[model samples]
Target: MNDSEAVMKLILHGGNARSLAMEAIAHAKRGEIAAARTALSEAAEELHHAHQLQTSLIQAEASGEKTEITMLLIHAQDHLMNAMTVKDLAVEFVDLYERMRASKGVEA
Candidate 1:
């Protein structure tokens, strides 16, 4: 696949992961720990997929193939990186919530 297509796929995967991670946080806030964990797991999976695609693209470029950069491709890369960042932070957030729940003697 071309650079644009590869980047777009990363965008979608990353966006989905970000959205799901945020939703997981929201669910945890509402005292839905199980649902939150499930959402978080899904988020992680999506992020892994995005990361794989991005790694592939980087490897292709490293192998001496020329990559054209479009504004949309840049935007996609931005989205994917931002999503990965959010996902990392979300892991801490989820863990904090779990601790809080446990402190309150609530089963997760």
Candidate 2:
């Protein structure tokens, strides 16, 4: 795929991951721990795909290949970064929710 196409894919994956993380957070807030965990897992898978794309681009640049830095690429990177942060926060939220439920004598 071309650079633009790859960047778009990265952005798509990142956006999906971010959305999934948000969904996970919502589920946790509602005390649906299992659904939250599932959403988090899906988000991780999306992030993994995005990371692979980013790594391939980095490797290409490292191997004497010139990469054009475009606004779209920067946006894609931003999306990925934000998604990762959200996913991390979602994990913490899920854990907290589980603990809260346990403390309330509820089965998680």
Candidate 3:
């Protein structure tokens, strides 16, 4: 893909991952462990796709190809980083909710 298209793909996947992660947290808050896990799994898949797209750029650079750093690329990177942070927090939130449910003897 062209640089612009690749960058857009990254942004799309990153946003999707972030959205899924947020959905997971919401599910967890409602004690829907299965649904939460499903959402988290989807988020992980989207994140993986984004990472793979990023790795292609890294590989091109390693091969002595110069890639211009554009504002859109920078924005894509920001989205990826933010998605990662959200996913991390979502995992912790899911775990916390699970523990809270267990403590209160609420069936999942």
lDDT of 2 by residue, 1-108 (tens): 777888999999999999999999999999999999999999999999999999999998999888899999999999999999999999999999999999999997
Sort by lDDT, top down from the best: 3, 2, 1
Show the colliding residue pairs in model 3: none
List candidate 2 stretches off by more than 4 Å. none
What's model 3's TM-score?
0.98
Error of 1 at 98 (Å): 1.6
TM-score of each: 0.91, 0.98, 0.98
Q: In order, what lDDT does every prediction score?
A: 0.87, 0.95, 0.96
What does the lDDT read for residue 95 in candidate 2?
96
Candidate 3 local lDDT, 3-99, one digit each (tens):
7788999999999999999999999999999999999999999999999999998898899988899999999999999999999999999999999
Give the per-residue lDDT digits (tens) of candidate 1, residues 10-51.
Answer: 889989999998998888888788898899899999989988
Superposed model 1: Cα runs more than 4 Å off = none
